[model samples]
Target: MNSRLPENELDELPREIIDFAKHIAALPDEFQDDMETAYNRVVDSVRRRRRILGLVQEALAQLRLDIKYLMFDLEMTRRERDELREQLGD
Candidate 1:
């Protein structure tokens, strides 16, 4: 198994987690199984959470843009209605 973690992962994950993985990697082959599995699980979980967070942030940004567009559309429609009413009154 590849024990070397990617540099980006090293930067994103907590130092303690990285240290623990390194410790597990350093173990003798016979002693590495259970702890290695646990470490892999933790790393996977963290990465999954980060991905989910990024998606949510992107969604929020899109929602904000949609809301601004809707607001502008509403204002333009109101102004047009008012202009038509003034022309009819004249």
Candidate 2:
């Protein structure tokens, strides 16, 4: 497989990823600080999303277990109802 990116897509990449030290050194101090702050915010957002995703997965697992129990209960109730009907007929 060709590892090289198409030229058009390459142009859309951030300069820092292409050449980190050179790109950061070329920028003014304030701009660099802003970039760092933005990067930190993105990292924090990803962490929060991962934590929420884990909680959602746990809830879904619990929901599946609850559904299984409810299905079993429904089947048991149906059997009891049928037995009661037979007894009443006899």
Candidate 3:
């Protein structure tokens, strides 16, 4: 499969599963390769996918934290602006 997803690759299916399918497509012919090696590759791919997912989850959590802080800061700034405006009689 291509390094990047093509338009057609987008679907209800998760990207990891789609990537796994792409990996499967590139796998060596079953009868031509050692079974153990093939199995190991498949296992490794699954492990990699899990790691990627964990990282994505961690990033999302951090983003949520950042957004929460930003919202609080925005409210505080708006309140300060209103106070300043009242003091200035504007």
Candidate 4:
């Protein structure tokens, strides 16, 4: 018989406090539609921002790779042109 009941001590709370608690308890039901709408808006905003960041990151990486390739190609082209010019004695 060492069990304990889950009764709360808030039973002795003042009327104002109890009323406040009741109001808080009813908040979910009272603001149901507004809460749902706000949650969806927040979730959708996060998804959109994440997608935008992903796209930006991908674009930047590709641009960096492109710049690297372009620089390598430019250096190779210049070397080849110089060799040809020297070989042709021009």
Q: What local distance difference test score does each model get?
A: 0.87, 0.66, 0.68, 0.62
Backbone clash pairs for candidate 4 read: none
lDDT of 2 by residue, 1-90 (tens): 012335564354455443543354477887877765665465456557767989999999999999999999999999999999999999
Sort all candidates by TM-score, best to worst. 1, 2, 4, 3
Query: Tens digit of lDDT per residue, candidate 3, span 42-78?
Result: 5566667878999999999999999999999999999
List pairs with backbone clashes in candidate 1. none
Q: Supply every candidate's count of residue pairs whose N, Cα or C atoms clash at under 3 angstroms.
A: 0, 0, 0, 0
Model 3 collision count: 0
lDDT of 4 by residue, 43-77 (tens): 45655776798999999999999999999999999
Off by over 4 Å in 3: 1-33
Query: How do the candidates rank by lDDT, highest first?
Result: 1, 3, 2, 4
Worst 10 residues of 3 by lDDT: 1-10
lDDT, model 4, position 85: 95
Model 2 steric clash pairs = none
For candidate 4, the per-residue lDDT at 43 reads 43
**Residue 87, model 3: Cα distance from true site in angstroms:** 1.2
Regions more than 4 Å wrong, model 2: 1-31
